[model samples]
Target: MSEQDLFADIRPYNDNEVAPAIQRLIADEEFIQAILHYRFPHMPGVIGSVAAPLLRFILKRKLAKLKSVQDVQRQVATFMNKMIETTSKEITFSGLELLDPKKSYLFLSNHRDIAMDPALVNWCLHQKGFATVRIAIGDNLLRKPCATELMKLNKSFIVKRGAKGPREMLKNFSQLSAYIKHSLDENHSVWIAQKEGRAKDGNDVTDPAILKMFYMQGKKQGTDFATYMAELNIVPVCLSYEYDPCDTDKIKELWQKKTVGHYQKSEFEDIDTIIKGIVGFKGRIHVAFSAPVTSIPAEPDDLAKLIDQQIWQNYRLFPINYLAAGIQDSSIDEVAVEQWQNRLMAVPDGAHDLLTQLYAAPVAKKQ
Candidate 1:
């Protein structure tokens, strides 16, 4: 097979493949079962038994007509619209008008939620009349064959995190880097997390290794590091959630890792987190897009720090962050502290301080 075909299984669905991809998803019983569960979460046993087939029938009718990616996006928009209304008190954007809609950008963002970080960025871009971006999803989330298809159909390309050896890992990184460059060359925007995983501690730091990977493919083309980075039009995106849906889960994971030396995720845990992040209340959401970093430094470490500064500067703070930071220094207003204390009453005692630190870490870092 050709290079494109070799990476076909990992790439997003093309326009011609969209219809068949949707068909495959519809036929996947696991996918259908997941839809049934999400559609009728409150309905139990017998009701679920009846509702599953009914919901699947309705989905078949709806999905069968979705022949293009835009058609699928329209359907996705409905859920996103609902999510905004139900989860957020307000959803706002900044710095979007500074961008040229015709230009493709590499959006490097601080990852908070499993899915919503990039989804919110895509939503904002789509609303601004810009093309939505293809997302970078990890291989760990694609444990099931159908899971891979589902993500690809939704414009997610895989990053091979589970490569066995150093040689294979380097090749995967090269392919990933090349794919990102190719997408930009085709005038397609892309969304990738600033780091390999969510900064579980809420510190918006960029990993130098990720920056180095971006240079790998460009180096092969004999382009200078700074020039190659500038040509990609890298933009820093900051997504702030007033209330992270998976805050407690994240705290638990962090706590486990700290105490036990590592945290092991159960099967479907990531999927569960994704569902929670989508449906749970977020209070208020703000996404800030930084101007393209045209003057990148030659050193990966320096470039990483530059990205971190942009992300930290653009990150919007909510009331909870102030409350969290106040708990540390006692500088916050008494009235606001009291109000947040009452809110904290709802959180479990075990996770209270850790969760507070999670929100406060960003504020502290920003300072």
Candidate 2:
């Protein structure tokens, strides 16, 4: 099969495919109910059910003009602008001006919030007149059909997280590797988390397995590891949130895993986390774009360390971090101290220390 055909199952919706995907979303009853629940959370279930048709009608009309991927993104940008204005105190970026807008990059970002990390990165690129990236989302988050459609419409490609066997896992990883290289070759950038899931405990460590996955296609093509890595233009991105919206949830999960030895996630927990990440208040946010990797390390472990160093060094430390780490710096004001204390009080006593350590992890890592 041709490369395009091979990646068809995983690639984002192209221009011609956008309309059909939008239609599918509009026609989906569950998608309409989700919108109603989000927009009118206090409404009775019966009332929401009754209003679903009207919601669908409104969506169909509002989305009818979105005939291409760019059109969908422009609509998403409007929502993003509103989200940033309301949810965040301020959003800032550094090192973006140094990069060439014409070149494509593989942005290896430290994941915190499930949705906001990539959304903020795309927003930064969009505001700076750079083309937004093709986001790499795991299939675990795409269990809902509505989600899959919405994500693909927003230029997100799937990463097969549910490969059943070793052979299937290898096949999926190889295809994913090929897809990233393919995207860069087509002058389209890609954004992927450094690890498999969000670093709920505030650590931003790059997994060497991810780096090795990037090398799979290179290995198949007989390209040396260093050369292939350099060719991919991998850039490390750091996303720092002053107050993580889902901090309490993360702390509870950590506490459970430590005390209970295991924690189970509900069926829709990821979806709930994504919603919370979007609408919840994030005090201040910063995105740091590091210089693309020029001198590539031959080993995945070494490359992981290099990426980790860039993320840690360039991370925009906030007052909350200092407060959590018990570092009495000038940046930690009375207000920040109160906020940190309030957050601690909000969680259970047993998890309070975990919450402190969660916010303090970055401070510790940097030191």
Candidate 3:
């Protein structure tokens, strides 16, 4: 559904809630063609030659008309193949056979590089015979050109900005929670960042707000948090970037945020950063997958803490990030700092500078 119709359907929604007559208009071939053309004015062969025709054929003639997950799996795999080519990575994934290909999962992950984080998870899921997961992407990035087009195609729905209006923001999250539950019920997975935005540096942390939102998803449904988490199959994913292409820009922004209380990206600048993050080479990057959250207390606060700890444990912090943080400030025990320095010294000289950038922000907070 488009952002407009989503606001209208604020109440409960079922699989058939998004009937073709209305939602189809939103996904109409003519409209998609126009958007694809607009976004890729210079590059049409991939979108027009393959994507446009295939998507139109499916949405128009095959969507609800088909019932098998096999069909969905095929489409998702092809889309991922394209994604692999588009993002250009030495993409390696583990924990491959743990999940049932057809069962749904709540894929919670650390937000490392922009754009690529969701894309990588989607790509891996596709390769493993799962349908593309619905994504939770913020409206701030959706305001731009490249980011907006890419995210939508990748199955992300909009999340309203804070300044939009307090009511509007909550309304957006409510819709998100509903949609996520719906996707899970339909045996389709959903991917969301642990935090709101991109990870500026290699160190990834879980945002308490994200856990709070997951708790909110099942609260009003008369379902307790543990039952909700168990049913949803919350799977944590860790994405490690050996080198952050946006390190300089992130440091610059970090400087601003530290010097002043605020910082904003120039129009389309975030897009540039995302592109660099995706294409950037991350050496010896690792993705650690945790078993799904099977057991938990019903209390929201307790559940939140459990989720936070799980996320932190999977966070793929490279040696550089640890070294940078450990060394950049001497107040944090010099002995411990020397340990990170020793570890950094051990990481091959070729990757030293990249590691330094990923870790050493020289700002109020470690990126």
Candidate 4:
């Protein structure tokens, strides 16, 4: 069987399918609506109705000639550049030189925003002249077929979330492990979250199950666990956002989960969060790529803790984070704390403490 056949159900869209996927995405009404709203946010009345079709035509014409993933990435970089320039005061990087453009590594980053975490990492890689990584996206986000097609076009593979039964779950994890190994062997880098979902409360924790999944195929092949992990060249990435666009929303969700023991997301909640994360102001953003973990611990939980430590240690603590911790911390300047407090004056009464928790949790955990 062909190597590609192993990942047929979960692999990204190939070059041959790029044009068709773009066509399908442009033709999708939901996609059109989203573009219309995003491009013409203030003018959603007659102006939007008249401009949407023309904008769609222009976009289709521009995208029609793109033949490869790199072409799409070049186009994506345009928007990323603009967003960074306008939304962020400065974007910084650390340990990027550790990455070799000629080699492939599995990057496991702490998830924050629904989209921008991986997108920011991709933008950095692109800027550094490295080949973009194949992202692991949960199937839950692809409820819209157009969304799935678009993500696949950008070299994102499905993670088969919501699997039923232990056997099915194990099968899914096995396939996922095999795909990661295959991608790296084929010289394609892979990016996955350290955990299954975004850490909404600002505490970034690695799930041991994710680490165990990485060892599934290697264990089956009778390879030593530590050697297999080293072969994968696993790297931990820390993504820090000075001002999370969905800070309040995440805080509310976290609070609800803590108080009610569960929280149900709205149908379009992820979509809304994704949009906000992209277009919202991030202040100063930093992505740190740690050295590859060559000496993996024997236990998955130990490995998870090691990753967590790397992420926490490398995480950039912004002034807002310090302010969120409290005025007595003395780590942050009084002026900066006052500035953040003034900004929070506009936040609703109930959300203020939750928002503080969202930013302060990281600082508290690091301490």
Tens-digit lDDT track of model 3 for 1-367: 6643654432222234334333454455555665566557676576486777665665566455423334444555665566556544455677757777878888888776667777678777666667767777676675544445445544566666554687776766777776777778877688888777766644455666676576666887878767876887988787765455555566566556666879986876765676567555444455656678788776656665666666565555444555665544334456546744654565455555544655653221322
Residue 178, candidate 1: alpha-carbon lDDT: 89
Candidate 3 lDDT for residue 223: 81
lDDT of 4: 0.86
Q: Total clashing residue pairs per candidate?
A: 0, 0, 0, 0
RMSD of each: 2.6, 1.0, 8.8, 2.3
List the candidate 3 regions with Cα displacement exceeding 4 Å.
1-89, 144-149, 201-203, 315-367
Clashing pairs in 1: none
How many residue pairs in model 1 have overlapping backbones? Answer: 0
Candidate 2 residue-wise lDDT at 133: 98
Worst-scoring 10-residue span by lDDT in model 3: 9-18
Q: List candidate 2 stretches off by more than 4 Å.
A: none
Please provide, for model 1 over 1-367, each residue's C-alpha lDDT reduced to its tens digit, 9 standing for 90 to 100: 6767866867898878888877787778788778777776666778777766776688788878888888777778888998899888899999998899999999999999879998999899989899899999999999877788778878999999988899999999999998898889889899999998887778778889988898888899999899888898999998988888787788888777767899999999989998899989887899999999977898989999998888888777876788788744444457556756765665567667777888888787777
Better of 2 and 4 by lDDT: 2
Could you give candidate 4's per-residue lDDT for residues 73-142 as a string of tens digits? Answer: 7888898999899888899998889878899999999999878988999998988989889999999999
TM-score of 4: 0.92
Off by over 4 Å in 1: 1-3, 41-49, 327-351
Q: TM-score of each candidate?
A: 0.93, 0.98, 0.66, 0.92
Q: Which ten residues in a row have the lowest lDDT in candidate 4?
A: 327-336
TM-score of 2: 0.98
By lDDT, the candidates rank as 2, 4, 1, 3
Off by over 4 Å in 4: 41-52, 327-335, 342-353
